[model samples]
Every structure is written in structure tokens, then in C-alpha cells.
Target: MKNFAYTRAGSLSAAAEAASAEGADIIAGGTTMVDLMKIGVRNPDALVDISGLSELEGHEIGADRIRLGALARMSTVADDPDVIAAFPALSESLWKAASPQLRNAATLGGNILQRTRCPYFRDTAYSQCNKRNPGSGCAALDGGETTLHAIFGGSEACVAMYPGDLAATLVAFDATVATRGPGGTRTIPFAELHVLPGDTPEIETVLEPGEIVTAIELPVVPAMRASHYLKARDRESYAFAAASAAVGLEMDGDTVRDVRIGLGGVAAVPWRATAAEDSLRGSPLTEATAREAGRIAFADAQPLEGSAYKIALGADVVAGALLQAKSRMGGE
Candidate 1:
């Protein structure tokens, strides 16, 4: 890593101000930031340590909502009894992400802000990654290692997938992100936090410079008790998802009362399958209906030569997740 000035911010205000400095980056769990720094993908001249800020260190689980501190470790959230009981999708997402050691060190805030696992973006050896270097051109589109690339939200500029598990489940649950910036604190829908590559792949997020995420807020989701997150990968442990689904369903006997679906490892952002949810609403929760919902979810997919298989794979993943979630609703 490059030599950089380090300072610990005593308060959120102080952290915000410090983060505004040129090439200054915030360091919380240091899982994503440190790895990017070491790989030369991110070379911040200054790192503002915010891990000591007690204001963003714990969680608040209420009957109506759940507020997860940005600094809360992934393992901590996964192991919380309240989270496990009320939000099974959220708990499962964290538990299935990364490895046990990484889960213990990764923070909720950092995980959402984590960059794409695109090899071209991480290895500076590639000279054509638009995300790493704007207007430089994207090699992944023509390079042929696109099995892991996006099939839903891709443009000519970039096709990289957003590699985040928690954000997918949070999007499924209609979560909001709390952030502190130079102007003050504000809350935005979690879905809007990540921006599509479009023409400007370099600008990954909507956050203004110097803004630091404070917490992730999830509204009370009664159906979330029957939710589940299932990931399909090449191997089991320590492998990134090829396609994953976070699904929540509320059933009244055989009919679907409510539904939420979020897809991962197949889009530029955490994808909420609203159309799929609409199709499944008020319908019987049967295997055929679930499969149809999954197929409808990928109606707009623009698949590349190598990643076309993901459309079918993604459909099956979503359908299986829906069935799994429904099974959890037994006796409820």
C-alpha cells in the first residue's frame, strides 16, 4: 500500500470533514478498503479511521424496524438472535458471504460499498477497464471471461456484476441507507445507493464525495420471517456467488399475499425483481407459478455470449429460493 496519512475521527462530523480531503478515504472494518489499497486499485493519500466512532457501532432492533450500524461486523449481525428470528434473509445473506474469518472482520457499511469482483478492475495490469479508468474502455465485454458478468443491467461501457450479499437482501426488504455528508445527514433508498455503469462507470455510487454511510435501516417486514437467501457458486466455501436470490413471501393458505425478490451476481446493482413480485402476488404459490415468476424476472436480460447460461441459471436460483422461502412459512 502507498504511504498515507492516518487520523482517527472522534465524531461523525469530524469524519465527514476529514473525508472531504483530497484522496481521503474512510476506513472502518478495513476489509474492502485495505484489500483494494494493497492491490493498487485504490491509493488514498489519507485514510480517516472511523471504527472508533461509537455512534455507528451497534444495532437497534425494534418491533417495527431494524437499524444496523454501519460498523457492525457481518458475523455480529448474522449471529444476532433478533435478526435471525425476524429477518432470515438478512441473516442468511451474511452467513453465506465470504468466509468465517472475513465475516468476523467485514462491516455492514463496507460490504455494501464494496467494489465489483471483476478481475479487470482489481488487476491494474488491464488497461481497458472503464471502472478503474474512465473512458479507458472495458475489456471484459470483449475479453470472454463473462460467465460472472452482469446479464440484466449492462451497457456498452461495463458489464461487471455487483458482488454484495447483504445489499441484495436489504434491497429485497426495502431498506434505506443513512449517510452523513458535508451538507448533513440524509437517508436514501438502498436501491438508489448503487448506480449503473452506463457511460460513467467510474462513478459507482450516488454518494457525494466525503459522505460516509452511517447505518442501514430495514422497515418491519412480517413476511421476511419466511424469507431466505440462497447462493449458487462453483464450489462451497470461500467462493463468490455465480447467481443468488433473496426472496420473501407471505402466503395465505395456498395464495401469495406479498412477495419481494432481489437478485445478485447478475446485475450492475442489487436487483429487485418488482415485475416478478407483481406476477406472484395474489397467485397460488405452486412450483409452476414460481418457475413462471422466475422466467418473467429475466425478461429484460441482455445476455452476452458467455453469460447467456446465467439467464436460465438465475431463473432456477430465484425459483428455488422462492420455494425454500415458502417452506419456511409452514405452520405460520
Candidate 2:
């Protein structure tokens, strides 16, 4: 890693002020940031450490909403009884993520802000990685390894896949991210936090430079209790997802009252499957209906040569997640 000056911000305002400087990056848990820096994918001139800011720690599970502080450890949130009971999918997403050591250290803000796991983007040896270097061609697209590339939200400039678990559940539950920056504080829908890999693949989130994510707010809903997040990977543990689904279902007798779906590992951003949710609104929550919804979820997929299997695998994951959610509905 490159030599960089570091400062531990004593307050939110101080953090924002320090991070606003040119080439300064924010560091909380340092899980992803350190790795990227070591690989030469990210080389900040300075790091503004905000991990000591107590204002950005802990969580609150209220009757109407759940607020997870940006610095709240992933394990803390995943192991909370209230979070598990109220937002199982959210809890599971964190649980199924990295190992116990990582969960203990990874913070909510850093987890959402984690970059892609694309080999081309990580290895500086590859000259073509639009995400790493704008205007550079994408090596993953030019007969490179594409099994992990995005099938949705990919443009001619980039096809990198998002590799987070919690963000997908947040998107499924319509969570909001609160941020404080040089311009002041604001809240945006979590779905809008991540931008598509369009012409500017290098730019990812909508967060402004020096903006610090303060917290994530999720509305408490009945359907969320019946939610599930299913991740299909090459192995049983510690492997990144090949295809994953986050699903929440509300059932009324044999009919579906409401549903929310989010897909990961197959898109440039945490993907909300609105079309699939719309298709299953009045339908029964059965294997057949779930399968149909899954099919609808991937209808617009534009898979690459090695990633074509993700369509089928992603559909199966969606179907499995929906069924698992249904099973949690107290035999409804």
C-alpha cells in the first residue's frame, strides 16, 4: 500500500471537513478499503478515520423503523434479537457474509460502499478496466473471465457485478441511507445510493466526495418478518455468491398480498426486481408462481458468455428464497 497520512476524526463535522480535501478517503472498519489499497486499486493520499466517532455506532429497533448506525458492526446487527425477529433477511444477509472475524470488524457503511470483486478491476496488471481507469476498455468483456460479470445494468463501458449481501436486502425492504457531507446532511433511498455502470463506470455511488454515511433506516413492515436471503455460491462457506436473492412475501390465505424482491451477483447494482414483484402481487405463493416470478425477474437479463448460467441459477435462487420466506409465514 502507498504511504498515506491518517487522522482520527474526533467529530462528524471534523470527519467531513477532513474527508472533503482532495484525494482523502474515509475509513471506518478498513475491511474493504485496506484490501483495495493493498491491491493498488485504490490509493488515497490521506485517510480520515471515523471509527472512533461514537455518534456513528450502535442501532435502534423501534416499532415503526429500524436505524442502524453506519459504524455498527455487521455481527452486532446480525446477532440482534430484534433485528433477527423483525428483519430476518437483513440479519441473514450479514450473517451469511464474510466470516465471524470480518463480521465483527466490518461496518455497515463500509460494507455498502465495498467495490466490485471483479478480477480485472482488482488486478492492476490488467490494463483494461473501465471501473479502475475510465476510458480504458473492460478486460472482463474482451474474452476475459466473465462468470462473475453483471448480466443486468451493464453498458458497453463496464460489466462489473456488485458483490454485497446486505445491500440487496436493504433494497428489497426500501431502506434509506442518511449521509453528512460538506454540503450538510440528507437522506436518500438506498436503491438510489448505487448508480449503474453507464458511461462513467468509475463513479459508483451517488454519495458526494467527502460524504459520510451516518446510518441506514429501514421501515418496519409485516412482510419483512417473513423475508429471506438466499445466496448460492461455489462452496458452503466464505465464498462470494454466484447468484443470490432477497425476498419478502406477505400472504393472504392462498393469495399474495405483497412481495418485494432483490437480486445480487447478477447486476451492476443491488437490483430490485419490481417487475417480478408486480407479476406476483395477486398470485398464489407456490412453487409455480415463485418460479414464474423468478423467470420474470431475469427477463431483461443480458448475460455474457460465461455468465449465461446466472440467469437460470439466479432464477432458482429467487424461487428458493420466495419459498423459504413463505415457510416463515406461520403455515399460511
Candidate 3:
């Protein structure tokens, strides 16, 4: 890793100011940023540490929504009784991520902002990763290992997946992100936080330079209490998902009254499977109907050779998650 000057910001405004400078990057938990720096994917000249900013600490569960402070530790949120009861999918996503040690140290904002685990992008030896170097071309597309590449939201230039668990649940529940920057504070739809890998693959998120995510707001609804997150991975723990689904279902006497589906490990972003939700909104909640909805979710998938299986796997994940959500409707 390149040597960099570090400054612990006293306040959110200070952190934003320091991060706005050229060649500067924000560090909170340092879980993801430090890893990228060591791999030469990130080489900032200055590090603005926001871990001490008090404004970004703690969480509040209110009647209307749950406000999760950006600096809230993953373990802390995962263990919150209110979160586990009302937003079980969020809690499950956090607990299922990384390991116990990482959950103790990693913050919610850093988790959402974490970079992709694409091998081509991480190894600088391969000079064809567009996400690492714009216009360099994507090695993953040119006969490279594409088992973890995206099936949706991939342009010809890039096909890397987002690779996060919590964001999938957040997107399914219509969460919003709050940010403070040099231009002041603003709220953004959680789904809009990560941008598609269009022609410019290096630019990942819509967050501006020096903008610090302050909090994540999730609306409380009846369906969210019955939500579930199912992650299919190479291993049981401390592994990135191969395919996952975050689903929330509101049933009306075995019929779907409302449903929300978010797909992970299969897209460039935490994909909201609106088509799948629409397909099952009024249908009976059954294995056949759920499976059909899952198929509809992946109907427009554009998968590479090694990633074609993700289309089927992701679909099954969605179906399973929906059934699991349905089972939890009133039993929780």
C-alpha cells in the first residue's frame, strides 16, 4: 500500500471538507478501504478518518422508519432486538456477512460503499479491467473467469457484480441513504446510490467526492417484518455470495397482497426484481407461482459463459426467499 497522510476528523463537516480535497479518501471502519489500498486498487494521498464523528453513530427505531447511523457497527445492528424483530432480513444480512470479527469492526456505510471483489479488478497484473482502469477493456469479458460476473445491469464495458448482502434487503425495502458533503446534506434513494457500469466503469457510485454517508433510513411496513434474505455461496461463512435473494411478502389468505424482491450476486447493483414482484402480486403464494416469478425476474438476464448458471441459481434463490418470507408472515 502507498504511504498516505491520515487525519481523524472531529466532526462530520470537517470530514467532508478533508475528503473533498484531491487524492483524498474517507476511512471509517477501514475494512474495505484498507484491503483495496493493500491491493493497489486504491492509492489515496490522504486519508480522512471519520470513525470519530459522533453524528454518524447509533441508530433509532421509530414508528414510521428505522434510522441506522452510518457508523453503527455491523454486529451492533445485527444484535439489536428491534432490528431483529422488525427488520429481520437486515439483521440476517449483516450477520451472514464476513465473520464475527469483521461484523464487530465494519460499519454500515462502509459495507454499502465496499468495492467489488472482481478478480480482474483486484489484481493489477491483469491490465484489462475497465473498473480498475477506464478504457482498458474488461478481462472478465474477454474469456476471463466470469463465475462472479453480473447477469443484469452489465454493459459491454463492464460486468462486475456489487457483492453486498445488506444492500439487497435495503433495496427491497426501499431504504434511503442520507449524506453530508461539501455541498451540504442530501437524501438519495438507496437504489440510486450505486450507478450502473456504463461506458465509464471506474466510477461506481453516485456519491460525490468528499460526501460522507450519514445514515440509512428504512421505512417500516407490515411486509418488512416478514422479510427474508437467502444467500447461496461457495461456503457457509465469510464468503461472498454466488447468488442471493432478499424478499418480503404480504399475504392475503395464501394470496400475495404485496411483495418486494431484491436480487444480489447476480447483478451490477442490488437489483430490485420489480418484474418478479409484479408477476406474483395477486397470485397465490405457491412453489409453482413463486418459481414462475423467479423465472420472470431473470428473463432479461444477460449472462457470460461462466455466469449463465447464476440466472437459474438466482431465480431459485428468489423463489426460496419468497416462500421463506411467506412462512414468517405471522409466526414471528
Candidate 4:
């Protein structure tokens, strides 16, 4: 928000070097960064804009994975024929995310890296938010209702949830995030990118300062063709989820051989509901089992004051999402 020097790098390495230095930040799509700046939540001394780097541009949807360019716009990825056909969950999450203009300007990597939608953090009116100032304490915990706060991996300190929808799709598909820096290239599991707030909400990810995301790779799954992302929000459209489910089920005849389950709106990160997934992995695909799996996903969720509905809503979400996915199979 304050006056900051800007540099547009020609290469990823150049961008990394500029960003890795002191008080420098990376700006790819600039959607999230600009918003944070406007709210006084982000004030960098200098910004290294990496949107110009050719090394971080373009993509290929493969049989094993969809190799995503860091700079690929959300609209482009959502509208790609292969993405629409092969990854219905991924495509749907993108399309359901924001307005058309926002999707056009927001890059895929930036969307995944976007921050929480927590009101206290966004407003900057509250001076006691620990995420904004360490040791300042969290006002959301005692002052506001925590229905939208986290139920997993939350410390007494903070409960801000990861507010991205696309990340849930990536988690369901077992995706990998690719990054590059002076140390060369390394790929991290998408699940590992986000960390629970625990005691440090300011430190959101593992990316060292100055590192630039190169790509995100999602594993291929035939189940994805039978997958769906169901978001239960306050409204039909243009609203963040109240509770959501991403489900992909593989059937061996009438029985399910494998299932991938990921949840949103109830946790600090894109939650891979392995317990729910385990419930459905080798069982018969029935509405009962799907609902039970949904129940298992939230078994460990400890709602604060008002979010206890997330437990029931989360169960219905998984059930609804799985049932919707099953109906999509050809000749179902």
C-alpha cells in the first residue's frame, strides 16, 4: 500500500533474486497482493513482479498430471477443454470461485496461494489479531462468533481458515506444486504447501522468501471423470462456502474400489479427509456409506461456539457431493 519500488523480471531466476532480498515481495497476478495492500495488511518495501517471466508461463494437461504454469490465468485453466473434460472438480472449483473479471486477472498459482477471508484480518480495524501482530492476541476468538473459523489444527491463538476453493480440488487429485529458486527446482505435495496457523498465522506457507512457483502438477485419475466439487455456501453463487466437499469415487462394478475426499470451509487448510476416504475406499458405494464417510471426515472436528452445524453440514456435503459424482457416470 505504501510507496514501493517495482521490478518486472525477465526470468524466474531474476525474479527469485529480486524477491529473495530484504523487504522484497513477489507479485505474479497481484490480485491477492493488491487487496492486502489496500487493507494495510501487506506493505512491502519493494515488489518483484514475476508475471513477465516466460519460465513461469504455459501448461500441459497430461495423462498422469496436468502440468500447470504458474502464470496461467484462472479463466484459461477453467475453460481448457481437457481440464473441463478430465478434471471436472478442478474446472468447477475455478468456475465457481469469483467473478469473471477476477478469474481473468487471477493466476492459478496466485489463487492457490491466496490468503484467508477472515474478516478481522481483512478489515485491519482490529488491532489485536495475532496474525497481524504477534502477541497482540486474537479478537475473533472471544469477540466474534467462530462459525467460519477452523475446527482442525487451530491453536487457542488463531483459527483463520485457508480460503481457496481450487486447492481443495488439487488435494482431491493428489497434486504436486512445483517451485524454483537458486537451489534449483523441487516439487512439494500440494497438501504440504499450507500449514496450520497453530501459533503463527502470518507464516502461511513453506515457500522461502523470494521463491517463485513454477507449476502445479495434479495426478491423473480416471475417477476424476466421475468426480464433482460441491460447495454449500450462504448463497447459490458468488459467495464463499459454508461447507464444501470434493469427491472422486472409483467403482469396480457396483462396489467402490477407491475414493478421494477433500473438504473445505471447516479447516485451516484444504482438508484431505483420509478418514472419510478410508471409510469408502473398499466399501460398496451406497448413499448410506457416503453419508457415513462424510461423518467420519468431521469426527475429529471440534467446533468452537457456533460452528457445530459444520459437523452436520459437512456430512451432508460429502454425501451430496459423492451422490452427485455417482450420478455423472455414463449410463448411471
Full-model lDDT, candidate 2: 0.93
Error of 2 at 277 (Å): 0.6
Q: Which model, 2 or 4, shows the larger TM-score?
A: 2
TM-score for all predictions?
A: 0.98, 0.99, 0.98, 0.97
Clash-forming residue pairs, model 3: none
What's the CA error at residue 33 for candidate 3, in Å? 0.6
Winner by lDDT: 2
For residues 73-115, could you state the per-residue lDDT of candidate 3 as single tens digits?
A: 9999999998899878989999999899999999999999898
Q: After superposition, which runs of candidate 2 have C-alpha atoms over 4 Å from their true positions?
A: none
Residue 43 of model 1 has an lDDT of 96
Per-residue alpha-carbon lDDT of candidate 1 for residues 1-332, written as tens digits (9 for 90 to 100) = 88999999999999999999889999998989999999999999999999999889888789888999999999999999988988899999999998999999989999999999998899899889999998988888866478878997889999999999887898888899999999998999999999998999888899998999999998886788999999999998877788899999888888899999999889999999999999999999888999999999888999888888888988999999999999898832
Candidate 4: 10-residue stretch with minimal lDDT:
323-332
lDDT of 4: 0.85
lDDT of 3 at 231: 94
Better of 1 and 3 by lDDT: 3
Off by over 4 Å in 1: none
Give the TM-score (vs. native) of candidate 1: 0.98
Candidate 1 lDDT (Cα, 0 to 1): 0.91
True-structure RMSD for candidate 3: 1.2
lDDT of each: 0.91, 0.93, 0.91, 0.85
